[model samples]
Target chain A: MPKKKSEESKSNNKGAVRPDGRKVDELRPVKMEVGVIERANGSAYVEFGKTKVVAAVYGPEPMHPRHLADPEKAVLICRYNMLPFSVEDRKKPGPDRRSIEISKVIKDALSTIVALEEFPKCMISVDMVVLQADAGTRVAALTAASLALADAGIPMREMMSAVACGRANGKIVVDLTKEEEDAEDAVDVPVAMSSLTKKIALLQMDGDMTLEEFEEILNKAEEACSKIYDMQREALLNKYEKEGKEVNINDE
Target chain B: MMSSKLTAEYVRSLIERGKRLDGRKLDEFREIKINYGVSEKAEGSAEVMIGNTRVVAGVKMDIGEPYPDMPNKGVLVTSAEFLAMAAPEFEPGLPGENAIELARVVDRGVRESGAIDLEKLCLVEGEKVWVVFLDIFVLNHDGNLIDAAGIAAIAALLNAKLPKITEDYEIVRDELTDPLPIKDIPIPITIRKYGEHLLLDTTALEEDVLTGKFTVTTKINGNICAMQLSDGMSMTKDEVLQAARMARDAATKIREKLFKDKLKELKKA
Candidate 1:
């Protein structure tokens, strides 16, 4: 017997099971590769389902534009670029207002762990390119860029990991895809944290939700980010292993 | 930072002893890392890190009028930017001579090697064709930017996909048709000669004291695609031939280790 359209819609919304069959609290599959760019001091490639991002780190070298050079510390710069065909619509090349805002936030988040003062009169640059984006690219870029910086052999107090959670349908969901992102009344909450200290480095929220729901989403994001932190560490360790270097994972 | 005479002399002395300050053999390259599909928005993108030097290359495709001379073939434009934040020496704004030279070297390698099958990119005979824009950025410069940039550019092209074109002539940005046809992989190897010693992948400090440098682009089939020589000093025919042989050997190793498996995986997708 054919089911009614209304009945089908209701059943689909009941458990908030996504089109890809992920539950409200589930995350998309993630893949990480470290030291992927041979020309950068450090580089990483990350994939969160269909969302893909690449990050490269270069520096502790002398800062350009002499005036911007801090005598007491190294300056950190982060740039994020999305290609024209990354989305359903073709985007123009170059930095747009949205990219500029995201770049600033990512820079601020990374500055927390970067021991900039250790290398005076120098700078560190982190460049991220989103080759394909389904959703949650900012978080993916942050996570990948941090790993790239680590791969560059930069001194850091701790590493940072990021993940996004949002309200889709009527329930909280982790790692929303583009379809879920476009749903009515959808809210996105992206959170980044210092892996060792467990302190929030970046927190941005959009849409509307109750305070309790927000707290639950944050908890879910934290849990997901923790898992990502391990993956980031593993990627870094694997690169060294491939180079025949012994890495003590517990040294941190 | 200016190169010090003391540092140059020290490097020369170390080279004479068959050693580098970083504790590497004269012909040994530093660690290489290549990652593709870094940019979600571009048709293709790659990031390459050779030791401390970092470069990112992104390929974008668009429909445009074909050139009168080559109406049937597609167009490939290459440009390079040396970000000011990458190094103290690099200035922002317009590309300097060094940046222009880097782009030309990479472009020559790809174009001459016929790495991309441009004929397949044509839409209309003389009216419309696909234009591939390959943009490279040097995010960090520890030296050997030419080799790194070339690798990134080629990898980005290998990773590229064509946007679906409807029968009605509408270009669909979201749906990808298939991977662009890649004919060959041309790998560039830059060698710096410091006094009598020839060094591979020179660091910035080493480059400052280099007597001369030459980059040879070799294809997977052990053929020379393009060659560039710069600086005041010159190399003899024998030296150039030796460099070519070395570059070919290195290209083969890189093709096998870094690209073979990845290319297979990309093809499967």
Candidate 2:
């Protein structure tokens, strides 16, 4: 299924049309599934077309004796992994350097949006595992994990969705795929945003874009994120409703 | 920790019964999976899995002054980090013995093979050259880190290409760049000696049965570049010779697979 879509998207790029014939602003199909992992405190599996991610949320529990607890804040630990078979070529099983860095960046990025002060002396861990990766995996993962945490009934100031806009073939392209990346010339501008206040949570970009282009794409991403933010919320609500029980724990 | 003496004896009994603790054959590799460009930000990246043993490798190229002694050659530095989460035994911050062994074995294989044409990486003779940093990370460990790390490091290097830099020193990366200065391709084959017999592709459990192991690295053209005899328990000349023969055959098979697969074609430059 992913292979066919990739081939179709490759042809679509050559024809100057958005893959799937959606508007430039339109996103590929976004689907979220929650409570997939029975063992984790909260869990979700999400897919944006061929890009798939599984997020497991654990903790808000007592920290190990060896780990010093914060008196006034909660700590969020995030680790991102991609299964070896997730790509066209089978990947190795372990975490790579890029994954480690992304894991750190993600932990820091989400820290800004989560209400850490609410859960003092507790730790929340989010493990985002990419079952398949095509493009925009980081964004897909960030959104999915946030929803999963909400589904798990973890408190937060707001849910976060990350996105990337890059200059490819001299034009601003949103969400690059492996093939499109090869065919075009571009620099990556990746951002993580909070849906609640419409504020930037994390911003990272590589390559050069004019200040005007940067602002333009940044605005586009923000607007796009608002729509994604809604989808993420709906997904979580639907997941809890499907269970036919309010699993919400008391805030205190 | 359990008693090493008792565990060692138990491992010997398993080998005698021809059944490994992990349910693998004496010569079978766990499961091999490879993924390329795992790091969206890396010049070249790959992750490989041999069963639960996972290694992620990425190649980062930078400009640095050449060493005074080796003015015309580029440099390749390999580093390995074993994360605490990868195994229950590994501790964060401080590297354990297994981690150190993993790093040294991988370094020896790549360095001794002379697979990379470092001289070609020199941008300005001895004054300026490219330094390729190969970083291997163990995220999960089931066993057999050496083979996994060796394959991941080279595969990542093979996947990597020089970034396009303009005259102004700004990166001009528009697409996948050119292949790195690769002269020869060398792959290492590890053989573990167990109870007077050597086996190919030992799993973590099988590794426990062995006193120690040795790896033989061979280049594409049947040239042996590096050999390491790991066990303190000495082996006679005949046993070493037999292991070399097994390694050569195993290496030949690995070489065929590397080329048969289209891993090297991802580069569009």
Candidate 3:
């Protein structure tokens, strides 16, 4: 669909039914798979409705260039790339300004969960590719990457779950699709939290809302993230279950 | 960035015997996979994989003034980026020599082949013209990034379309008009010389021991459009000619196998 028409639809549908016919605070269906790529130390694939992402983890290996190595903790590098066909328009294949910024935030979000001090002078790399994109791809990528890190056997405090909430057509929505995201006056707030501790690890906002609206969005996102966290844990369990080994998240 | 001496010596011994460590013949290529329209934000894009090596190319078209030297024709700007996550050896920063060389080689092949009719892109002669930007990105660096990037660039260009243009010289980005003017397919073939053996499509391990490398870009008519020789070890004239012939054959095979199906699909779309 053209950008103009999508924008127009956003305005015309104010206070009306959503395109997907879900409640204002409902999330799109999510699916996750672990150990998807053999080349990387660990990998995962995730789908949040129409958005699809693949994440790969490498290292706890030695850092390159020598100088970038930290003396006390491992350095984390995250990269997010959207494939050319991932969206309505073909995206250029590299790290543009948006991707670079997204990479930094993802790295920071995952850093809180990873026990980087356990591997001194080492590096942990996370690579996420958006095979298809609708909206909230950055959050989806981060969610998959966190799972990949755990699958790689990297020690961490807890797994992270990320979700985005926003105001669409004057109503708060838990997860916005591409069309809703393009709507004018839409306010997006993406939040990530530790599943075990419920501690916020990442928060970002665009557009505007009242403090009460922001808090309401946060509460809704937290609720959605709890469900997402269970899904992530189940994906890990499924992989280990297939290997015929009984695994426990708490034991690890 | 350097391979162990023991591994290098082992590779050389195998090459001397007309065998590679991967159990393939000296002239054998690794498996290749190509997918078109991998990005939706650009005019055209493709992702290509040669063995473990992966590269993506995206083409974006915009209106701009023509270059002083080519005022009557459109312009093609090519650039390459090596993602730090692709390989441990690749660091995050500006483009280095390898990145620059890769972009130039791919650019030269496409430009010299007359693949795109630049004259058709001109909005107004010497005033405004359509500038085509080909951005190549290395997503994985197992080896042989040149050939993979070249293939991606060609595939992306083949899939490109021009946005609708208005009479007042405004470009309606959301409405695409027609496919870009593409004339020929240019394929690049790179051969690595390692210890008296010319190996085609060397893996990362083999690349460390290679003393010389030669790349030949061939067009559909069996004409050489661009040729580059990275000097490390010297090559005889006959050796160069033999490598060129091998490259032409490889290009032809690749065009038939990898490009034909995609071309047909694009035409139907």
Candidate 4:
């Protein structure tokens, strides 16, 4: 049976039509599944509209190149990759400047939430590959990476979530699409926040916008993130709910 | 190298006492210098120095095919090279993550601010357009390479003059026309959060002890054009907003002070 993602959320910007007809504040349909990869210790496949990403977490295993070992804490490496055919243009297969920067920012966000101290002298690698991208791939990849990390039994201080917010037709909107990103008036900001505590783990933006406009869209993005976090928790719980197991996510 | 614990603790104590090793205020930046025409062969170039850190930015123009998505506009490619001569830690190989991150962040600040009027750079719509290559080189890396490099980029761009084109769309370097059309100036300021204290333009040692950092870029209107958050740090929403405010002020200060002499000379020439 094909899963029917919900898109019934009300529009925040009344009278303004989104490109895909989503509500101004509504996210694209999201589908998240955990442990989809068999060989990886933890994995997740997530989709937001046309954007699809798979994240895999491997090892608190022994560190390679022993000299790189941080005697005091585990080394966490994040790789954000886009497949060659992920986008409309055929991207060269490798770590390009864009992907390198995205990986660094994702690592920065996850580093704040993961309990890396518990796995000293080890290496934990989180990799996210974009199978298809529209826009907001960075945030989508971050969401899947966070889920994969949690599913890997990596200890965490808080549940993490991310979403992109920007303007289309002069109205602030959430989960921007490619057309919106390339729009003349678009001002995009990708935000990552703690699901429950609401602390900002990551904040990045491009495009010129007044401080007031940025603050407004940013607050909306945070609210959307909390909701996405709930969806992530539900998906994870569904995996173990079949066995009548209660996970201690405490996301509420 | 000091132990991470000892270094962090030392820095925290100093911050608690409201004192920096160099005796500058928490929000103070090191002395900054901006010199134009550093590269004799480049179309436009500048060298920026902040305290002991130094960088050179050079801009080269070439005619190239425009992207399919933005066929009527030109392209601006920003790149950074962390040379081994800049610091001991830098290796003599391809740019690792730091250089790539720096280039991307700076690129966003410029591109998103609409600093360059790329549409005007088109020679033939959908056929060819001018490509501006801004290459930044780190000659010395005490700390705060981002701010220094960002300043150099804008200065170099401002220093850039469009070369007169040949009838066949070739760039004629000999006949220069006007300055590159600049709608705005995007200046980026990086603030390091250390032990509850926000330090601006930190040194290498200060960077070593930083709990986190945020780089905020602003244009002439004081609106944010770009921003980047460093690793392993979390801040309250209020705190980030506060940092944005601080970045605006720092950018203004840097702009008004450092670029003063160069702008005057440009008008004179």
Candidate 5:
């Protein structure tokens, strides 16, 4: 609670510290499970440390009659939401400004990674729910939701992974947590990238940073994104391997 | 005081014969299945299926200024969408009364319970904080949305992890990962009062036949945090006490199932 201690808390993490007395660019912990829901096209529950997200992908079917159809492309709509009780504090339940913005951001980000041309005239509903949140939630959701889509066998140009980078007390940091976000005098930037193309899909920023600082953050984000990409690959591989054995047995 | 309505009589007959209008028992809860990480762009998300009733809850959070009235507290918002895809009853676009009521009920249950430590969300004493938003979508509707929504909401929250931060209000992308600031946990149990009977979970037909419905939410410490009675129904003193007791027991059972030893395992995975 003291200023000096608070700064120390920022430099030090929960229990473990980095070689530089700071936490390394490590994911809190990545855990995922498939088919937790019975009636969805595909579903997955992913946890990045304490940031938990549930991703459900529904449909490659007809578009709503009222909504205009994209003649040459598929429409992938993404809705990002959090339950009132998902956080430590109780939230009013409704579509507020933040949700609408996040939903739009997510939708735009996913468009870059999905092969919409293949499912022409079809619509895919990607719904992401935040049951809990820490920091880097958007990035975590982007990575986790993509894996869920893959689990459902949705066609994708590549898996999307994301991470947050920012300048805190003149230091660039990776994977911001709630505690650090509160203490640091810095700027936050969250970016999403396609693993296959290694191209940025979504870029958002808050606070202030110099051009050099921004470049550093981008470099850090790229490195962090690769790590997240590895995790996403591992998750999908684990799921497919498990399902492959089941498929082989069914064929027999 | 039996209404002479045929629908009421028919429902009573079904119950008397140990059959529900929807063919379920008095204490029977509809089947529930949950899938996590359904959205490719949500921080935490889950879909809950209870019989034909389906609800998906997702968590999304961002940094913002704390409210002046509650500087130490964070912002949490919950919204429910009763989609036309759920059933013929639900309309498209603008939420109906049912959706509004559902969102308010869940919101009150979580908010009044003081489940999360709001003060922890404070960054600079009203300067900034993390605003967590939860959205609920009713993908299908057979009945019992309260239970399904609650389950999905909590599952999504428990599955969430906090981001690491640095000194000066910035997120530390690489350095840390910790659990979100959770101080309280509330679980809701929905009860339907039928003809001289109290039911734990109800289907659509049962809901239609019921005189009234109420939900009681309890914290992990065995304290009742919030209550919502729908359809403008009132309960007798004895009925209220009995419902409270039933709700407490139900909450305990649900918590055991939802937060099983597997939560730790799920986190480690």
Candidate 6:
């Protein structure tokens, strides 16, 4: 609730300033790294401001309980979990209504882009663990999980990015803080997008807003997610470069 | 029987020509049939059939302590029970993720809208309040369960009677007092993307091969109460906007055709 630096609202010109003094369009500082876990086939860590998540991918292997396996395609399972200490209150370990819903949404988002047909009768698992408490954890987890999949060498149509954009204090902003997210007037919309394809992989909205407000936020989220997409690819390329592997990430 | 791969290919072949296996248009929903007051004991009930997909929703009232956060508001719970007889793949045990998502989508749509006027359900502010339970039972899974369940919920809630509150702060199960305080009608419109086509109210066969779906719950005033995109599919920014626009139009059609009297009453009010 404290302002560090004063700035004007960029797009809406509502004359409303963010609580944290960020521009309406400015995203929080982001950090992304791939291959963070050596034991996992692929793993990545992503942070958006105070929110942090680590994602690991394992699969295209034999699926347990053969009945759940797809004979012509791989089954994609995603679990989004938060460490007990990730929040202010000690969250009881295990999936609650919130976590179960979050996990399902993340899985649905990933299922669209992953090339499941490439591995028949196999299963792919993507696990994301939140290490810090903050708003936009689902988006953070999704951003990390996609990178983990790419790092695992699992085929994908495109590398995706996710972000939460909403209205706080009557001004549209990207990557809201937990404080702003809980505000009465908040209009929280979490989205996942593929920049190159101009596709929306996941979308969910809560709080209150008009149709026009929702549309404006969607445009903003698209721009923010595309920017995050570039950052994700850069982090991935950096990983390959560090490993001394010649990965010519072609524009095609 | 054709293999799933073959059936999928056959379905896609039909969709490529803007056709459906059942001779319906790309955006055409199957005929919706509604039967009210099927349950005499329940406070409210409705059976909705979209094509061969049948679902029943029942409303029951309970008196309970209010939650700490909002003591003045009553609680609304929407749950779905998928019967094994509904489909071969469905088991009789716990509610699966699909059932949970169906319930949640319905719940959010109802709660986000001022449909029930939760504040009015409160009797003794922080102590006693009415807890409304809306349960959806799937008797058949022909596809597009969300829309059916959503419609049944709103329909049942519209006709639901609030049980009389006793002097002792208890609910009289058999004695009905008045109708539930219904304000807005939120209709969930599910439009899916099949290749480049945006299909509405798909049947079971068509749902199997669809790439993406957007379940947007639009209120009568054209404002959105809830929105969800299912599966790991992606749509262009244009497509996303198109879906929202489409939802509003479809919701309007559904309201005019089904809840004509209700909307007329709402307008008169």
User: What TM-score, over all chains together, does every model reach?
Assistant: 0.51, 0.48, 0.51, 0.93, 0.48, 0.91
Interface RMSD of 2: 23.7
Q: Which wins on lDDT, candidate 4 or candidate 5?
A: 4
Report per-candidate DockQ. 0.01, 0.01, 0.01, 0.77, 0.01, 0.62
The regions of model 2 sitting more than 4 angstroms off are: A1-16, A19-22, A245-252, B1-269
lDDT of 6 by residue, B28-120 (tens): 888999999989788999999999999999999999888888999998988998999998888999888888888998898898877888999
DockQ, 0 to 1 scale, candidate 5: 0.01
lDDT of each: 0.81, 0.69, 0.82, 0.86, 0.70, 0.87
Candidate 1: misplaced stretches above 4 Å?
A: A1-252, B262-269
Ranked by TM-score, the better of candidates 2 and 4 is 4
Alpha-carbon deviation at A111 in model 1, angstroms: 45
| Model 5, docking class | incorrect
Question: Which ranges in model 3 have alpha carbons more than 4 Å from their true place?
Answer: A1-252, B261-269
- Residue B231 error for model 2, in Å? 46
C-alpha lDDT (0 to 100) for residue A24 of candidate 3 = 78
**Using DockQ as the measure, which candidate wins?**
4
Per-residue lDDT of candidate 1, residues B1-269 (tens digit) = 35888998898899989899999999888899988889888999999999989999999999998888789989999999999989998778988656766787788789767788889888999988999999999999999999999999988998899998888667788777799888878888887776556788889888887654677787666656665554423443345556667777877787787788655654465
Task: For residue A34, give model 4's deviation from the true position in Å.
Answer: 1.0
Tens digit of per-residue lDDT, candidate 3, span B159-187: 89998889988989888878989877889
What fnat does each of the candidate structures reach? Answer: 0.00, 0.00, 0.00, 0.85, 0.00, 0.68
Q: Which stretches of candidate 4 lie over 4 Å from their true place?
A: A1-16, A244-252, B1-7, B260-269
iRMSD of all candidate structures: 26.6, 23.7, 25.5, 1.0, 22.7, 1.3
Candidate scoring better on TM-score of 3 and 6: 6
Better model by TM-score, 1 or 4? 4
Please tell me which predicted candidate would have the highest TM-score against the true structure: 4
Global CA lDDT computed for model 2: 0.69
State in Å the error of residue A20, model 1: 69
